[model samples]
Target: MTINIIDHFNEYFEMVPAISDELKLEVYKLRYQVYCIENLFLNPGHYPDNLEVDDFDPQSVHYLIRHRKSGEYAATTRLILPGTDNPEKLFPLELYCEIDNSGVMQPINREHLGEVSRFCVSKEFKKRKNETHTLAAIGPDQQDYFTSDERRAFPLISLALIACVIKVSHENDIRYLYATMERSLLQFLSALGINFIKIGPQGDYHGPRWPTVIKITDLLDCVAEKKPNIWNFLTNEGSFGQTRPIEKPSKAVRSNSWVGT
Candidate 1:
C-alpha cells in the first residue's frame, strides 16, 4: 500500500499545508459554509455548530492550495492516517451501515486505511476566473467548466477538494481510502479520475433520498501515477500537512445515525 510522494504536486498551482490557525479556521469556515449552508448530502442534519468538523480532525492532517504567485487559499482537504486518532479509521462507515441496512459496509476494526473528508473551498476564492487555467498541469478532466465564476466554481470546489486530500494521503503512507458520497456525484468523480467501489443499493438517507457509500483507493492510485505537479507540492512542501497530530477528533462527530432501512 505504498504511494509515491512526488505524484501529486501541481505544476501550475502550488500546494501548501494549511497549518496556521487563521488558515485552518478558513478551512473550517469553508466547511461550515458548504456543508451547513449548501446541504450537499441531499438531506439535512442537525449539525448544530454550523462548523463542518467532526472527531476526525484530531487524528487527521489538513492541507490547503494557493495560487503559486498570490498564495491564496483556493481549496482545502484533510487526511486521517490509519490507526492514528481515528476511532473507526474510516469516515462515517459505521454511520453508513446504520443509514442503509440494505448491506454491510464492514465494521471499524480499521486495518490499513485512511479517511478523506470535509473538503471545500471558499465561495469568494472559487469564483475567480484564473483558477480554471491551472487545469492543464493537473491532468485532463476540467469538466468543471465553471462557465461563470458562480456556476463554474461549484464543481471546481469538488475537484480541488479531492486534489487537496490526495496530496495529504501520498505523504502520510496511506493507500486505502473511504467515503460516503452522493450517488449523483459518481459521474463527476469519474471525470477527475477518481475510482470507486459502490457498496450497496439506494435505500434511505433519513428523509428524502439515499446517499451512496463508496471506497476509493483506486482514485488515489491514479492521482499518484498521473499528476506530477500535485505530487511535488505534497513532498517536502511546507505548511498544511505538518500538524501536531492529535489522537482525539478536534470535535465530536454526529451521534445521529444515517437514514433507516
Candidate 2:
C-alpha cells in the first residue's frame, strides 16, 4: 500500500504551539540541545539554565513538533512578531544585515511583518544518513521506534515548522516573513516551491546566511500549485487559507547580487 505522506507524518508527529510557560520551556530546552550542545553554534556556558533563549523570546511565539510515540520534542521554531508599541523596532535580520531599502522592501508596512527565527531540529530526531554528524544518540533498544514509512516522512518536520509559522502569521495579520537562511536551507525550500527573495548580501552570522523575505500569500500560492499534497498538509486541509489577496512583487524590484566574503 502506498503511504500518504501527510497521513504518515501526522501519524507519528504533532505540531504544538508553545503557549504555556511549561511548553515554552520544552522549546527552549530543545534549542539548547541543537544550538548549544549539538551544533556548538552558541556558547553552552552562557545558558546556565540549559535553555537556549534570548531577548527575542519575549516577543516571539514558538512552536514545536513532538514525536507522538516517544512523547519527545522533535523540532522547534519561533516567529518574532513586530513590536506592538514600536513597529519600527528592527528585527534581527535588519540589525545584522544591510537590507536594500530601495527595492521590494521599500513599501512594506513593518506592522505586518514578522521574522522566522530559531528554527532547529532536535539531535535525537536527526535520522537521515547524511545527517549522521547531527549527533543524535539513538540507543540500541530504541532503534525500531520509528517504522520505515514513518522515517521516510521525517523531512516533513521542517515543512511542519513552516506551517506553524503560517498559522501564527495569519493570526497576527502578518503579510511578509523575514529570515536569514543558510544557502542549503534556501535551496531546499526553493525546491519545495517555498521560495524566498534574497534581499541582502550574504553575512557570516551562524555561518554564511542570506537575508531573505517572502510574502505569505506568495508562499501559499506556490506551494498549493506546485505540491498540492504538501500544501494540504501545511494548510491543514485549507483551514489556514490565505488571509490577504495575492499581490505579486513588481519586476522593478530585484534581488541583490549574492556577494560573499
Candidate 3:
C-alpha cells in the first residue's frame, strides 16, 4: 500500500507547544501518568500535585501531541536548554551519565547544547500489545479498534513528537541535542530512518539506556534522504527550512565551540 504518511498523520495528530503555564502543566501531568502510573518508572507518591516536573523544566521548552478526534493529549517531550542565568548547570544526561565525547566531531559549547528528555506517550494512545494499564480500554484484538486509515495514523504519535523536537530545536537556534534512550527505541527509530550517533555506554536508568547525540543538520539530512514524507511534515513542505541539504558547521562557528563540559 502506498501510504502518504504525512497526510494520514495530520488528520489525527496536532502538535502544541507547551509555552504557557496551563500547557506546561498538561505536559507534567501526562508525564506523571505515563511514568508513574503506567510504567512505574517513577513513584506516584513523589508527585504530590500529580505533575512530574523537575528543576531543569524552568529553562526547558516542551511540546504535546493531541489526538484530534478525542481532544486528548497523546504524548509529550521537552528540550532542556542551558541555564541562561548561571550557564554552568549541566544537562540531565551529563549530570547522570558519562558521555564519551572523544568521537565527537567538534568541541561542544554549553550554551549551544540542549538536552532532549522527558519523552513519554500516554498509555491509552499507544497501540502496541506489550503495554497495559492504559486509560484507553483497547480490546485484545488491535484490528477491532479503528479503521485502516486510523490504524495507519495511530502509530505516528511518537514520530510526530520527534518532529516537534526537531522543529522546536531549530526555532531556538540549538544545533546540538543530547538524549538518553532505550537501545530498542533507538533501533526502532533507526528502522524508521531517524538515526542518532551513540556516544556513551548503555546504562540502566528506568530501563537500559544509551546516551546519544545528533546535530540538527544531520537529522534533517537523514529525513530528507530516507523519509521524504516525514521531511515534508517536519518542514511544512519546504517552508520550515529543513528542505535544504544540511551544511557542515563552518570553521568560524566550530572555532568558538560552545559545547558544555
How does residue 137 of candidate 1 score in lDDT?
A: 18
Candidate 2: tens digits of C-alpha lDDT, residues 149-195: 67666778888888888888888999999998886678778887999
The 10-residue segment of model 1 with minimum total lDDT is: 252-261
- Candidate 1: count the clashes: 16
Per residue, candidate 3 scores C-alpha lDDT tens digits across 3-96 of 5566567667677888888998999999999889887888999999999988989898898887778979888899988788876787888788
Candidate scoring better on lDDT of 1 and 2: 2
List TM-score per model, in order: 0.54, 0.86, 0.84
Q: Number of clashing pairs, model 2?
A: 0
- Residue 146 Cα positional deviation in candidate 3, in Å, after optimal superposition: 3.4
Candidate lDDT scores, in order, read 0.47, 0.76, 0.72
Assess candidate 3 and give its TM-score to the true structure.
0.84
Question: CA RMSD for every model?
Answer: 12.1, 9.7, 8.2
- lDDT string for model 1 (1-261, tens) is 432222222322444566777767766765666555644542225555555666767677777655443555556678766655434543555455334443434542354567665554554444434432221112223334334333422443355556556555656655556555444355556554555655545544422223343344445445445653332322222223433222222111111100010
